[model samples]
Structures are given as C-alpha cells and as structure tokens.
Target: MVGCPLTWQRVSINETIAPEDVAFIIPGKTTLAEIVARLGAPDEITSPDGRITYTPFGLRMITRTPQVITASYPGAVARYRFLDFKRFRANFTWGLKFIQPVPGIPDDFVFESGGIGTDEFLVVLDSNWIVRQHAFAKHADASRYRPWPFDLEPPDDNQVVSF
Candidate 1:
C-alpha cells in the first residue's frame, strides 16, 4: 500500500486567559466611561492595536401545573417543575487603540511583543503615543512566539569624579 500523509489531531486544546485581563461580558449598554469610572484608566493605550469587547447572557424559568389540580378550583395540590439552561456569552472587539498595559516590566528597559496571536498582546507605543511598528513572531507555525528587544542592558553611569 502507498504511504499516506501524516495527520495530527489537536486534542484538549485550551485557551489560557490572564487573571487580570479585562473581558467585557455586557455589550452596548456598557461603555468605556462606565469602566473608567469603576476601574480607572488603563496603564497604556496602543493605537492600531486597540480592542473593545462585549458579551451578554440571559436566564429563563418555566412552571407546570398538573391537570388533576386544574379540576379543583382555588385550593388544590400543584406540582412544581423547573428547567435550567446553559449560559450564553458574546464577544466583540470595537475599533480603537488597545488601551491597557500589563505591568511587571523593569523600569530601566522596556518590553515589546509581536502583533496579535504572538502570545499575549503587549504592544509598546512611541514617545508621541503613536504605534510605530508591530513586531513579528519568531515562530510562525506556533500560536505564540517571542517578540523584539528580548534582552536588555542596564544603563552605565560609571564615571570617575574629579577631586
């Protein structure tokens, strides 16, 4: 028999979201203003890499009565029934600069990352608060890869003082 192309199946693929990553669960009715009033401004705002999201879910209930109870006027035994439903969720990203910054970076040096899908979005804006350029993923095949300026050097202030 002729050899067949190898097939790989991805099983148990899971998406890991950061604990602090803000995800909007309610759309439209909720706005950025409400978020700001409740949770202050984001640490950083990334133009061209912006994102706004919204989601909504609903709950419903149902009741049933037995036919035997219907015959008996006001006072009769009634059977209660209940049914639960799975929660629904919606997600959407509005057009705007990706506003927010993830801390834990050393102040002396800054960290940048490749555009979307290259691990968590950690884009760095220029001094003028404009997006300069997006970094590319180191590994194309994988979902995530390292970005630019991975290594950094500490500033040198070693100069002899004149007496």
Candidate 2:
C-alpha cells in the first residue's frame, strides 16, 4: 500500500557568500573598509582579547558549529552559516478519514528519507582589522536534491565503523 505522498523541501538561512566574492581579499593588505564594501558588513564582529563581539541571528532551527578562536587585540570575524534539507514525509493514521490529518490521533507515519547539507564561511581579522585569515567550507553538491539522503558514492576505506 502507498503509505503517503512524499514532498521535497529546502531551507536555507542567510545568504551563502560565493567563493568568487571573497577571492579579491588579500591578507595583510586588504583593509577592513574594503572588505566591508566588497562583501557588506560582516554578520558578527568580535575581539577575542576584548575586541570581538558580533553575530547574526535568524532561523533558529538551522544548526551551525564553529570552532572557538581567540584572536589578537581589536580583531573581528565574519560568519556565514547556511543549510538545506530535502524530502519530507507526513505520517498519519486514518480510522475513517483518507487525506485530512486527524488531530490527537497518532499516525503510522515514517519520514523514510531526508537529507541535510550545511556550509559555513568565516573571516578573521587581525589587530589592524585587516584580513588576518579566513576559511570556507561547502558541499560540492549541497543544492542537488538527490532522492537518497544517505551517501551514495563509493565507500571510503579510511572511514570504517567500529563495533
């Protein structure tokens, strides 16, 4: 029996900065004002040693994990976090109804398959507020809505599971 219909969904938080947009940044040379003009104001600015404090807040559901870094005097950081999900299933139990979900009634619904992909970009500034260092991580296929949520590529020999 066809359990239920399947729907694909996507959700993203904040605009993901493109690689090209930041390519022009030259560490030790790019000034803070130039960086801001090129990429707009950073989401968050902070000084580890009492000079950094800023972050963007929205779409509380999306999760982002960032490493704690303590920068030098009067530094700053720019952070961008984005995530996308796909394939949503609605489980419902029907004793009489066919489509409409009945409240208070537990349904035999299983979200068979879904996927989540996330990306983050971080820019760190030095005491001079110049481009001290930066890093960016993204999934090559973060946008592709593959039917299967799990990894389909050939298994990695190094990534072995233990009992």
Candidate 3:
C-alpha cells in the first residue's frame, strides 16, 4: 500500500515464425536445403543415426531435445527462435502481487517486471531430407501492457500450435 505500479508489458527476443512460412514446407516436396534457405539454419539438429548426435540447451547442454523436436528416421529438426518477453512473463507466475498502491508511499513505483520468451518453430525432415513433420509448438500471439503486476485474466502466452 505504498508504491503504485507504473508499467506492465510483454518482452520477446528474436523473430517469430509465421503460419505462412510453414505453408511453404511440404512433407515430400520441401527439401532440407529449401528449408534452410527459407528458415535459415536450425538451432539444433538431431540425427537418428548419430552422425551429429549432440544438441545444446541453454547454459548447459542437454542431449534429449529441442523445441520438442524428434523423429524415428534419419532426419533433422530445425528450430527458429523468437523473443517475446511479455508472453514469457505471463507463462510463469511470481506469486501474489500488490494490486493497490501503498497508502504510505510518497512516490508511485511501477512493478516494472517482465522477461523475454523463446518462440520456436520446429521442422522434422525425413531420410530424403524432405520435411516430414513440423509445428509452431509455441505460437506467439496477442499480448497487452497492464498496470497491475498480476494478470486478472489468463494471458494468451503459451500457445502450442501443433499441426
């Protein structure tokens, strides 16, 4: 009951993938090289045969995943990274927050809290290096800036656009 919340907003990193981008990828028609040209290099590529078996995750490297990408045959997983902090802030909770301004505080202080999110688009390729499967497990969507620290309504932050 002292400081008033000043700002509320979403933050993001990198560029997000669009549905139109996915449209260009055909399971049999889309080749690995074509995807590379359209979406750039993948953040992590997992080979079922273990040619390049290592995959890095965060500060520490993890071997079992990426953007939730995996397949049964010789293929590749392409990950597109996008930054959206506003969406990131909504996904995780920071516990209860002060909705009202402090009665004793002289100046209004904004919650000024938020973080960036990693929006990913993963494309799984087949043995022929053609797109076998893909999805935007994390589709970046609508967001807003609020004065309250906590969202009165659930934020449309974590969307799993599976296809």
Candidate 4:
C-alpha cells in the first residue's frame, strides 16, 4: 500500500516571500525603509507604540518603527512549540513523486510534506526608533507516519522536538 494512490495524495503550498529573502534582512543593517522597498508594505501596522507586523504567506515579521539605528539579531530565543497537526497535514504530503523539481509550482496544488510551522522575526527599537534588539522564533509539528485512513496520534508535547 505504500506509495499507492490510496495511501498518499498530492499537496501544494505557496509562500508569499521566500525564506532566503527573509534571511537577507540583516538584523543590525537592514532598515525599515529597505524592508518596505524589498518586501513592500506589510499586511498590518499597529501604532501608539509603533509595532509593524508583516504576514506574507507564512512568514511573520514584528518590528518597531523605522529607524536608521543598527538593529540587533538576538538569535532564536523563544521556546519552540509544535504546530497543529490538522494544518500541517493539510499542507504536507508523504511521497517524493508528489514533489516537482522546479522554482515554483505551475499547478494549483503545491506538493509539500511536514507540518505547518511558525517562524517569527522580532525587532525592538529604542525611543528614537533605533533598532535595539531582535530575535527569531520557530516551531513546527513533528513529522510522523500518517496512514491514508489518517490513524496517527497527534504530536506529543512532552517530547522536545526540533527541525
């Protein structure tokens, strides 16, 4: 039954922005103006304290107001959490045949495997809008053997999983 149609199905997911592009954004060097220019406007912007969040596809960036000051990349600081299985299953597949070797999927379905994970980029600015500190947080549900009938237990929270 393995690799059989009944046991597997094709799935596809599109990222609004590429992970490499996000990596290009330097913590102490990248500026808000440059981010807007490179990535365009964010999905949401919050004022008062000046918090800007961009949600492009699956990537999330939370930063303070624009500033010329050098920003800091605190590295991964937050505790990792497992993503929801339902969402992960919806976006993932279990076979190499389902994957297409190309820059982008032309078809409606974007064949992908593994659970949906959250990668967060955080930036904190000083009162003058200078980048003070920053951090990246990521969490993904563990990939497991899921039968076609979907009879697999959800990821256990007790386990310390990493991707």
| Best candidate according to TM-score | 2
- Tell me the TM-score of each prediction against the true structure: 0.17, 0.58, 0.55, 0.35
Between candidates 1 and 2, the one scoring higher on lDDT is 2
* lDDT by candidate, in order shown: 0.29, 0.64, 0.57, 0.41
Highest lDDT scorer: 2
Residue 104 error, candidate 4, Å = 47
- Candidates 1 and 3 compared: the better one by TM-score is 3
Q: Which 10 consecutive positions of candidate 4 have the poorest summed lDDT? A: 74-83
Q: Which 10 successive residues of model 3 have the least lDDT summed?
A: 87-96
Model 2 steric clash total:
8
Tens-digit per-residue lDDT, 78-118, candidate 1: 11111122211111221111442435532223232322222
Question: lDDT-based ranking, best first?
Answer: 2, 3, 4, 1
**Candidate 2 lDDT tens digits, 1-163:** 3444555566666577888978988889887789778777765565645444334332334347664756656666666666666555544343324655767755564444655667767777777778888888776374555554456688777987789
Report the alpha-carbon TM-score of model 2 versus the true structure.
Answer: 0.58
| lDDT tens digits, residue span 64-89, model 4 | 66644233433212111223332222
Model 4 lDDT at residue 98: 60
Error of 3 at 61 (Å): 9.3
Error of 4 at 140 (Å): 3.6
Model 1 alpha-carbon drift over 4 Å, by segment = 1-25, 50-163
Candidate 2 wrongly placed segments (more than 4 Å): 1-4, 48-74, 88-111, 139-163
* Model 3 lDDT at residue 157: 88
